[model samples]
Target chain A: MKHTHAEENYLKAIYMLSEKQESLVSTTAMADFLHTSAASITDMIQKLHNKGLVIYRKYQGVTLTDRGKESAIKILRKYLLWEVFLVDKLKFGWSEIHEIAEQLEHIDCDTLIDRLDHFLGNPYCSPHGIVIPNADGKIIDKPRWLLTDLSEGASGIVSAIKDDSVAFLQYLGKRNIYLGAKITVIEKIQFDGSTDITIDNQYKINISRKITDNILITL
Target chain B: MKHTHAEENYLKAIYMLSEKQESLVSTTAMADFLHTSAASITDMIQKLHNKGLVIYRKYQGVTLTDRGKESAIKILRKYLLWEVFLVDKLKFGWSEIHEIAEQLEHIDCDTLIDRLDHFLGNPYCSPHGIVIPNADGKIIDKPRWLLTDLSEGASGIVSAIKDDSVAFLQYLGKRNIYLGAKITVIEKIQFDGSTDITIDNQYKINISRKITDNILITL
Candidate 1:
């Protein structure tokens, strides 16, 4: 029932990739995502297949079996819960908690996780606005769109983010952009696709299309 | 420098053994303490010696170098701090925190550990009454004696314990024996070494010499 740290990481990778791709995840894609070699990905995929965690095809790719999906969700649940704890309780910057949560997620103690959930008052989402899956792997996810997708004059609250990289998170932190912050698009530059937006109607600034694309919003 | 989990475990084993023996730790003793083979202990000792973490001499056993001792104390600090957090914040029983702390100690982030120390209000000791080393590996250890050494009519407060095994802890828990509890020895049996004692002037119980020897008390 327990997986190695490497195995858990692979499962999480496949799960994330599957969420976006909606198909079997290629070994090449897995290699790129994990920054590993294709040969190593193939080798690990075969190992996971043998463990009944994944279904691997020679040319097509690999997909998580039911068991593997459960494992991945458990890891994610721990990860997001720890992220909430780090930011909400420990006062760690939101940008600083990802790596720590990455290490904490692999700790295999259901009771500790449950106790932490209670200790944190059972937060519904992480600081990044990502919904935290429950112990039963049930998640309450809502539809959200990238900030760049909104038209001029459109206003909405920040919901989630597509990128969780430190650089991106730190950039948002410096700009006072955070989950649940309200923003209204003032104008869109035709040439660069950048948008001028007012954050809580306090100040206006132009952010690149790339940054806008990563910021999810709920109108 | 970062050490692998296995290397850290070896360092901790050597440090603990050195504390008790006040000399080099034999490969046989290390093997027994780690529940591993002597061959493996020798192999790891040789590896640690190469890494300047330990000094290994043939037949005389192994001892931690200054670098190795620092690593061991760091792990101990994390372990004890987490035990305090689990008991004080998360409401875990004293007996249940040891195994969880054992796993948490290997988390290798200095910032996280320091923040945790601050969050716990810089506690000086763990729930088991063991002095927790600071970030600089400095510890404030008070002198204490095993309960079995006390004579009849002797009175003291429980300060620490020599054994942290779950069984021993659970036994103490069931008998209402805890750190800071006052005890007065009523009778000492000469034949078996078992003694009768009152806990906090609440109840009297007869405990075996093995239990008495493990419980450290401060007069």
Candidate 2:
């Protein structure tokens, strides 16, 4: 079923929020994620529920039906593909592509997106190392560990990022950290959850617990 | 100023309609072009006028202000650039790219567009051979003539297409006619205004006057 831009956005927001929390996605959380009002979220949730895209319970929140999940996956597929195109082809910084890809993701054309995926050589991950859902809405949930999970001697390759905020990405840039960088935990601070890591076995830098929590790595 | 998708679409429609006629664009013509009601067109035109994007004179119609024209040209630039990307890179047919480009043109990012322009190697025209305006919104309107104006035995290279309708473009595709094809007028029938032409000194086909009038050629 064809969906409006607003509807698609709500689906994506609900999908993302669901990933972080196992419980039903709260309307307030959705409102915060979308930077909208609680009342607006409730109204849209009703619209989505009527469309059979979501199941909403009074005072509880909502959950996507199977159809809604599929629709949201399609949006993610488009978003990741365009992000790949922007970073891989157009030479945009990984941090710079999310907002642009947000707009591109709403472009309603499945064939165009399939063609773009092929043009970009069918990337499996976005520039931020996030896994891209396949054309059939299948995504492989690869094993990943947050940087904070490692001990002082543990080491791994940066595989994905949990946070894709521009400020976070810019900070990563300033720290010379990037996807695929081989990192070794040099020191684990006992006072705080901060960690000192050597990047690619080269430059050593200290990162806070917040940074470590967001940076996913594969041993 | 940032423009909504509907507002930008109206600006583009006005710009395109203005190109066909020298006078102000009528609400009826805009409604026809946009497939909306005359009342809706008037409502939108009034909104545009309030933004100083257009000068609306009741009954006579509307013309874009300088700022409005610039905004329209920027939309055109994005549209044409995406068309080039779709056809040249994504391998989409010339006819198929317009609708996709229509969605892509509304992507709002000056830096992304500039990067895309650079990535596409600074194309001069779109897949359908329409001149693309530069970043400054300056377009070089090259001289072109309708194929119907070409006399018998006159020949030139096809430079642009006035009608980008899917049916017309598909017909051109079926007949192996394309942008940059060298077409020679073999015969022009005065009775019905249909013309016989040879394409690339190889394939010969007869096309209707409607086709001839829509194909633009340069001597």
Candidate 3:
């Protein structure tokens, strides 16, 4: 089925909001996430609902139908696979790939995606440490924890990035922090939530609260 | 300045039609090339002209402005690099990469395209034998000849495929013909344009005029 780029983006937003638990997502929440107006979100949601992609209820929210979920996963699968290709194959830094992958996700060729999936050796997860759902949208059930949750002296491998922004990723890259980089927290400042950590037992770096909150880790 | 995908397509069409001799392209010819109406072509050509991408005259057709030509080359460069990645890295047949590349060309990132070019070892020609313009929109000049032009017992390497259709490419692939493959014409059937040829010093195949006209060779 063909969809306008806007419609597809809405489906992806609703899917992500409801990923952890299949719940109805408020239009207001989606509006905030997309940085669009609530009225526009409501309008788009109703359009998606009419297309059998979502179930929208007045004063309630919206939930993806089975068809909608499949579409979202397909879009996400392409995005994640491209991220892997950009980072692993093209040698693009993890932070630099998200925007590029965002553009690549809409290429609309199942054969190309399948070929890339095979070429990448069928990875179980995206470079960001997030689950990359299979053809059936089934994924491994490992939950990721934010780096901000760690206490002083806590150590773990960087599992994923909560903020995949080029600026943030570039900063992390400059500090030698990336997926699978081992880190031990030296201190966590309560005043502003800033974090002082030793990365790979080598460089000691202090990051702002915004940065710490965005780096996910697995203990 | 961002142009819609439609506008970009018009620029590419104008550039391609003008490729051989930098001549003005007629609206009827462009309409024929794009499978659109003359009226629609005039409308788009006007829009592109207003945007400074091309210069159009009433009864005459259009010519790409410097800006328009640059944009077209950029799009073409992305498309060609992806063809290389698909054929060389992902092992897709040369015939299958064009459609996928058509979608990939609009990715809107110079860095991504440049990185891909570097990753693909900076090739000068696409899998189909067209030049891949550099970031600066520069390409080496190499005139290509048609396979149909080859006489009996004449030989050269397969340099490009004029027919980018998957069916034609798949046919060529099945016959073990590809870019850089050596070929010698056994005979050219005069009644029909079909040619019998030996490929790569091994495989012998008889290809219809439809296929031969579309395949290019360089001696």
Candidate 4:
């Protein structure tokens, strides 16, 4: 089904909110996330509901229909592919690519995007470690847990990052922490939730609770 | 001044028409070029005039103001850069890239496009041989004339392509003619306007006037 860019954005926002919250998304919450008013969100939600893209209840909030989920996933696939292109090929910093990819994502040429996917070597994740949906919209999501959740001496490879702010990624860069880096928590300071860790089993570093919470990994 | 995508398309159509005809762009001419009605052409022309983007007269037709030409060129610059990316990196055939690029040209990020230009090695021409404009809207346009216009024994390098239809580009590809290939007209059969040519002063080939007229070259 053809959707205006605005409609697609709203659907994508709802899909993301539902996934993150694991529940129906309220119009007020969507308005805050998208920086619009509750009135505008309600109006667009009604339009999407009429189009069968959403299941909305008067007081219970809304969730995506199957078709709506598919559409949002497609947009996400395009967005992630474009982000990869910007960072991997175009040499853009990981911290500076989202807004540019937002515009490129709306271009909606399946052949162009698929060809771009092949061109970029069909990566499984974006630079941010967010999983990229494949051609069939399947994402083989690996189980990941926060760094702080691991017991002392437990080791895992950094498989994903949950924060997007530039400062956080740059701090990780400075500390030599990134996706695929093998890490072991040497000791845990439970008083403030900081941990001493060895990366690649080569160098030991210490990070605070904020960093541990944002870094996710797989055993 | 910000122009809508529709307005940019109209200005670009006018700029192209005036360049091709070397005269004012009539409302009828614009309507035909844009696949719209003359009434709709006049409506847009009025809006453009109010914004000082175009000089439109009731019966004398319309022409782009300097501002309008600049706007059109910016769109063209983005359009052609995307064409280069598709062919150079994505392995898309020149014949298959124009429509996809038409959608990408509307992505308005100057820094992104400039970085792309640098990333692509700052190409001088698109796959079709159209010059790419620089940051300040400067284009170092080479003087080019039709292949037919050159006399026998004249040598020139193919600098530009005059037609964008898929069939035409594919035909050129099949014959091994491309931007930067050098050729010399060895003989001209003026009766049918067919010519015998040697490409790169090597492989001899014969082409009709139709092909010669569409291949622009510089001595």
Candidate 5:
């Protein structure tokens, strides 16, 4: 079905929220993410439900239907692929790709995406470490471990990051810790939820628990 | 001033046509490029002129104003940048990115392009070998020579291609001649308007004069 950019956005937001929380997404959350009012979210949610792109129960929240999930995944694939293009091809900062990807995700052309996939050499993941689903919505599974989940003395290469914010990515840039960086967990602070890590034998740096959780490692 | 995607498309078509031939863009030509009717082109030209984005003189034809030039360049920048992103980052086939870039150029965000510029490492040209203008519409100058103009036995690296059509790009792909291929001109036959060329010391090939004109080279 032909959907407007706004409608597609709502479905994508619901899909992402549901993925993160593993539950129905609240109207307030949708409203916040979309930067629209709760009333607007309600209206759009109802519209989406009617279109069979979402399953919504009043006041209980919303989730995407199978069709909706497919659509959302398609949009996400475009988004992440464009992000990879921006970062890998255009040399855009990792932090800056999200907003551009948001705009690109609405481009409705299957052939374009497939060709883009070929142009980018069929990347398995985006710059931010998110998997880009193939044309059939299949994602390549990679071995990953969260930084916070690693024990003291554990070591691995920095494979990807969960958070894609420009600020966080820029911080990683400043620290010289990026994708493919070899890292060792030097110490774990139980009290403050922080960790000391060494990168490439250069420096030992302290990172907050929040930052640690955002980093992904591959053994 | 904000312009709709449809409006931008119209202006871009006019701009490209005017650049190629005369300053006066015909409604029929506009319609042909935009896949619309002459009547629709006339309607859009009137609107664009009314908004001071174009200069229209009835049947005499239409031209873009300084403002229209700025707007067109902006769209061009977005389009080319996205093309670079698609081919360079996402691994999309060059033929595939044009249609998608056509849609993405309308996304209204200045920072997105700038950030994309940084992410793509400030590419001076797109995958199709089109020069990418800077934010202020200043084009980056590169030393380039057309394959048709090169003397027989002249050797240079393929820098860009003049043609962007899917069929043409795919043909180049089939011949293993693309942007950045090291090519040496072997023989130029003036009568048949064809050339014999050697690529990377591997194979000597005969190329039609028409194809030769489309290939751009750099020393």
Candidate 6:
């Protein structure tokens, strides 16, 4: 079924929130994410339910139907693809591409997005390190090991990170451990879960447990 | 001053048309370009005149002011840059990016476009070979020579082409002489205004003088 940009956004939000929480997406949460009133969310949800895009029940929240999920995934693919183009090709900062991608995700052309995917050389991940799903919603597999999972003396290349927060990315920038950096685990602190790693035969840096958990490495 | 997407489009159309034809842009021409009614065009043009974005005189057509022209140029830059991203990074066909870029040009955010400019490495021309004006309206200098200006046996690269018609672009595609392809002039037949050119040392093709004139070359 044809959907408006506003409807697609609502569906995508519900799909994302549901995935994170593993439960039905609440109207309140949808309203919060969309910056609209709960009543508005309820109205929109009802419309989506009528269209069979969602399975909705009052006070029980909502979960998208297969068609709705497919639509949401398609939007996500376009969004992440555009994000990769913005960062990898255009050199846009990761923090900046989100809002623009938000606006771009609503562009309703499949061929354009497909061609864009080719233009970007079919990037596996966006600038913020999020995996971009393919046209059929198949996720690209990349070699990734968690920083905290590495034992002392284990070595690998930094492939990508999971967290996309601006502050965390900036901290990574300061540490000089960007994507494609080679590093070895020097030590692992038992108490706080921090790790000491050497980068490029030069600087030895201590990474907090929280930060280490977010970093991904190629085995 | 802020302008709506509709207003910006009108200004851009007027600016582009004025560059080729008379300074006065007619309602019928604008209506044809925008696919809107002549009455709607009249209403919007008057509104733009009131906002001082255009100079409008009854029965004399419309002309954009300097401010309007600047805004129009900015929109053009965004549109064309997005086209580059769509084609170069996303792998979209030249014909496909135009409609998507049309939608993208309406996204109102300077930070987004500026960052996008940086992300796309400040491209001077789009995939369809249109020059993208810089932030300050400075056109990027490229080594361009018209196909009509080439002497017999002169060698050059295809930098851009003037025409965007689907048939012409398709013809170029069929001949494998897209932007950035190297070409060497083989022979020029003055009688018929036709020229034979060698492409990438593989094939020599004969092209009419009209086609040659429309194609731009880089020395």
Give per-residue CA lDDT, model 2, range B19-86, as digits (tens).
99899999999999999999999998999999899999989999999999999999999999998788
Report the number of the highest-TM-score candidate: 6
Fraction of native contacts under 8 Å reproduced by each candidate: 0.43, 0.91, 0.74, 0.70, 0.57, 0.61
Task: Count the clashes in each prediction.
Answer: 0, 0, 0, 0, 23, 14
Q: TM-scores, in order shown?
A: 0.70, 0.71, 0.71, 0.73, 0.72, 0.74
In the range A12-81, model 2's lDDT, one tens digit per residue, is 9999899888999998999999999999999999999999999999899999999999999999899888
Docking class of 1: acceptable
Give the runs in model 4 whose Cα sits over 4 Å from its true position. Answer: A143-219, B143-219
lDDT by residue (tens digit), candidate 6, B1-219: 787778888988888888889668898988998899999999999999999899999988998898889888898888888786665455455666778888899887787787777766666577667778988877777777888788888888776777767787778878988665778988988899999999987799999988998888877
Q: Write the per-residue lDDT of candidate 4 for residues A127-180, one digit (tens) a residue.
A: 787888998888888777899899998999786677877777778878988656
Candidate number that wins on TM-score, 4 or 6 = 6
Per DockQ, the best of the predicted structures is: 2
Docking class of 2: medium
TM-score of decoy 6: 0.74
Q: Model 6, residue A42: displacement in angstroms?
A: 3.1
Relative to the real complex, the DockQ score for model 5 comes to 0.45
lDDT of 6 by residue, A77-126 (tens): 98888787666555466667788889888888878777778766666666
DockQ result, candidate 3: 0.57
Ranking by DockQ: 2, 3, 4, 6, 1, 5
In the range B25-107, model 3's lDDT, one tens digit per residue, is 99888899888999999999998888899988888768988898888888788878888888867878765677888788888
Model 4 clash pairs are none
Better of 1 and 5 by DockQ: 1
Candidate 3 lDDT, tens digit per residue, A1-219? 777788888988898899756568997889998899999999999999899999999989999999998899888988888887887567686657778888888888778888898887676567777778886677666666688888899898776676656677678777888666789999998898899999989999888888878877765
**Positional deviation of A15 in candidate 4, in angstroms?**
0.9
Whole-model lDDT values for every prediction: 0.87, 0.88, 0.82, 0.85, 0.84, 0.82
Give the backbone clash total of model 2.
Answer: 0
lDDT by residue (A48-133, candidate 5, tens digit) is 99999888999899998889998888988999888877765555776666787898889898777887787777766777777789
